[model samples]
Target chain A: MDAWFQNEVTYPHVAQEVLDAADSVRATLPNKYCDPEIAANLFAEAIDEYLLCDDLGINVICTEHHAGINSLLASNPMLLSILASQTKNVRILSLGTLITLRPDPVRVAEEYATADVLSRGRLEIGFVKSGLSEYASNQASPIDNGDRYWEAIDLISKALSHQEGVFSWEGKHFTHRHVNIWPRPYQPTLPRMWSATGDPSTAGDVGRRDMVQVLVLRGPEGTKTAFAANRRARAAAGMPKPTTDRFAYAALVAVGDTHEEGVRMGEKLMWFLNTSLRSAPQFGPKLPGLAPPQAAPGLYRTKPAAAKPGETASAAANAAALMNITAEQAMARGIMFAGSPDTVHKQIMDFHEAVGGFDHLSMIGRSGFMTHAETSKSMTLFGKEVLPRLKEVKTVTAGYNQPD
Target chain B: MTNATALPASGNLLIGDIELEVVRRGVGQPMLLLHGFQNIEPDAPFLDMLGDHASIIAPSHPGFGRSSRPKDVETVYDLVHCYLALLDSIPDEKVSLMGFSFGGWLAAEIAVKAGRRIDRLILVDALGIKISGPETPDIFDVFNKHPDEVRKRSWHDPAAQAPDYDALSDSQLANISRNWEALCRYGWHPYMYNPQLKRWLGHIKARTLVLWGASDGIVTPAYGEAYARLIPGARFETIDAAAHHPYLEQPRAFVDRVSRFLKS
Candidate 1:
């Protein structure tokens, strides 16, 4: 079972004084008044944390978001390249790059391929339609996002594939001539491709493409249903049935010596969820044209509806709903896994049983305003006690997908 | 004045792969009325008013209203060619052309491309030219404002601005959303203005009247004047006590000025 950690370099020092100063001037300061020095440290610290995870048999997944207070990581390719250089053996996944927002596909192809070569075939290309906020910030028309994303993926995939001779692309959203990518990927074929979404409708599309489907923010039942539907679609496509290896889930996690310490540490994840999730509503106005007309409302409701007044309410509600549970509720619901090493291990096993088991467990380690030492302790404990005990557990969905 | 309304004959005109919904009324010289980004209803009072004069051919731009928008029709240039085809198909050898807001920009584009087919041109607060002086707010600002705030900028009488959204049918709502999406497809990239449009404005030889709402904040009257100055023989006129849509706010004045210009 490959373990992965998804992280963003969130701004470190969000002082009330700086916020007050910004509010006095009536300026909505960029990135929650992030001090550049603090942000720089956070970036370096995040890389170091990933390096630590490397030592612990955990792979790294770097993702991107735009114009948000919490997320300081806006460029996935740039971060992934750095990860490629710093880490060895551990796979580096963008999990994904915002494909829809990118204006140039050739550049994306070149950058990711470079990273793949740098890592010597230990890279996965994850493409995402991204969120509405990115489209708005980049001033790209939201209505064309789906079309643009699919077109971009096609262009990038072909560019990376080891097709001999020069090729050209003529897509509705992009057109390029003389397309021979230099420094082709280390792998003969393109690296593994991933499509991340909360939308069930995309399951068939992802399955048809034979790409891994990474489910985000979906609870156990939802994950199971989505995975089953994807498997069914692939089977219907006459492709091999999908295994748990073809699926991955993201969860907020913390581990400690005792349940009480775990719970206390888990509060930091709740803070991260609430504060980071609050920016979700601002993505709506930006998505007017991005989503299909009927699907627009679903995009907003992707998270739990919020209680706080105005835009942040839905995001806050989503966070609160996810984290407000008792440990028992958490275990049953599979919303989060936070406890002692034994408890956390059992909870993961139970979740695996419930969802029919997925291959990758993506832990969000450094969340909210949690201190480095606290997250470091959680990581150390997870590596020391949790991972070793689970080594003997057999793959649950292995061989479900027949090999090509 | 007749209390009864005369419903225009509606039909679909197949221009290549596109099926354009066209409404025509009153037999005379053909006068094509192109609607704004937010399309006017088929039975809008202004259409009825125009129906009393020249033969009115009001067709929704492709991807708007009941029209079929083919994927091939991606840019404003595609729309211009489509309108040109519509012009050629009409019985009149030379037809008067009038377009509102986005439609006005289309009319201007058409005039620049094929001005010989246009006998006269009228642009009502068109949104497709970039001006340097007296900073003009991008038409995309309407998307950022509250619907009511946008309403205030769109009408002289605020009472006329309140749309009972609940009363609208599902199709009406869908059409409204589709209209905005189409606008985004055509104008969102360059932000509602064609940067190269100014260069081609000199090519338009049709006797033109560039109309504006005197109090229009959507695109200032100064912007309208700049639009008029580009055309060699175009006249500029601003209707008083109105915002963006003078035809909706002050119908009689709008019809009178437009009719007088087309006649002269």
Candidate 2:
């Protein structure tokens, strides 16, 4: 298993009363609340952490969100460039720069190529089918965003891999008359592609494309379901079944000297769900094309219904389940692993075993209010103690055990 | 051209590969009713009232009701072209084209292109042109604003006029969602207006009437007046105690006001 460390550089300094009063904590929140001095310190510390991960021999990840306290990384390529140029050894994955929101995917291709060259071919490209408040901030329509997402991926992939000079792309979502970048990617082929999705439909696409699939915060059941869909889709397509290496699970990971300390730190990570997910109706469930029209009964009716919201149904549904979740509950469901090194390891392996075994463990690191010192301490401990044991778990052919 | 009556019949119209859900009623000169943000509900009282005077042919735009929308049919331009094709299919010498809100935008576009095919044009709280300065938007952003605010802006008395979603059936809710999705796909960029439509409004050959809800916060009476001024010989009128959806809010007054214009 390969462990990747990630930090969202969350801003939790806003007054609780202000957060309570705002219709949305993201996109709609005024920029006046974001203190630049504090943001600078956050960037500095987060960069230091990335560098530390490089030294400790753990892979690093950079993700992007806009106009929100959840993350200051609005520009993934900017951070990708920083990590590409600064970090010495470890692989850097951009999980990534909301490609669907961008007006031009060719420009994204150029940015990725530059990062790849700077990193000496250590970059791994990842796509996120970004939605919700992101649509509002980016001024991109949420409707048909999926069509745009896949088209951007195709354009970026072709732009990177196609050696034959200037090519033209006329796609439904994007059209470029002349598509040529100055520098081709460092790797002969495009950096091993990754897509972050847990939905069965998107997971199937990931499987067919053979890209690594990362499921964030979805516990064993949801993860197992998505993996099964991936395997099933590949089999149906007459493609070889992907091994465990193609599947990855992301969760909050906080390792400490003692169990209580780790659990306490892990609880801090809950702020991501507890606060950052607060979005207005227009930017949340009401966003067009976020779900099928058939899902409208669940969304539009003011009266509560008896149907249990399946965890893997959609991100909005998943967000509802995650909000207000306790550290113990998160652990029991395999959404988190926090304890002494032995306990954290046991929790991870148990989760791995439960979800039919995945080779990549994306350890979503410190979140809101987790201080720089504490974050580094946990990372160092996790890197030094838990990672070696995880590495020993060999990649196996993936399979899904259906819940009876 | 007579097809108008008090009772309406629901059926499907096949236009090319697309099958459109349509309602036809009454027995008089042909009147093509272009619905607004939402498709005209079959039970909406104004439809039957309007049907009593003129034959009313109301088809839900692609992706709106039980309509089939091709993957490529996602823009207002596509809608205008589709409606133009529908006009060609009509047996009438000329059809009176009436549109509400988003449909008003479509009617204006169709009239601009349809030429002699459109005899009389009516826009009810229509949204198709820019009538304000760049910084000041003319239309309320229904998709971005708070739902309470949107509901309040949509009706003179939201408590009575606003839909109680809990009371609606699953299919009704699904239709609402489908309409919303289609609206967003067609109107999300440049925000429910065609930048060039204002410039072309003068070119419309059809005799025009622009109707508005006096209490419409979505698009004010002033914007409707400005819209009328842009179209040659177009007259502007407002219905009292009505908001964005005057037809649904005050069906009798809406029909009477429209009936007088059609006669004149």
RMSD of each: 5.7, 2.8
Clashing pairs in 2: B3-B26, B3-B27, B4-B26, B4-B27, B4-B28, B4-B55, B5-B26, B5-B27
Best candidate per lDDT, number? 2
Per-model TM-score of chain B: 0.91, 0.95
> Scoring model 1 with DockQ, what do you get?
0.28
Question: How many angstroms is residue A198 displaced in model 2 relative to the true structure, after the best TM-score fit?
Answer: 0.9
Q: What's the distance in Å from true for residue A299, model 1?
A: 10
Docking class of 1: acceptable
lDDT of 2 by residue, A102-212 (tens): 999999999999999999999999999988888888889988888898999999999999998999999998999899897999998779989999888999999999999
Candidate with top DockQ is 2
Q: Write the per-residue lDDT of candidate 1 for residues A1-404, one digit (tens) a residue.
A: 66788667665366656544432111134654667888787888888888888888778899887766557787888889888988997888887778788788988999988999888888988887775445556667767776787889999999999469799887788989779988898888889998876455576678778888877656675666666667767878898666667777778778889977886787666655544444334344423564444432333325433332211122223444664454445545676688899888888877777666677787877776777787878888998898887665656553343222
**Residue A334, candidate 2: C-alpha displacement in angstroms:** 1.1
Highest TM-score model number: 2
What stretches of model 1 exceed 4 Å from their correct place? A12-32, A163-165, A279-282, A294-333, A396-404, B1-9, B25-27, B133-138, B142-162
Worst ten-residue run, lDDT, model 2 chain A?
A302-311
**What lDDT does the true structure give each of the candidates?**
0.74, 0.89
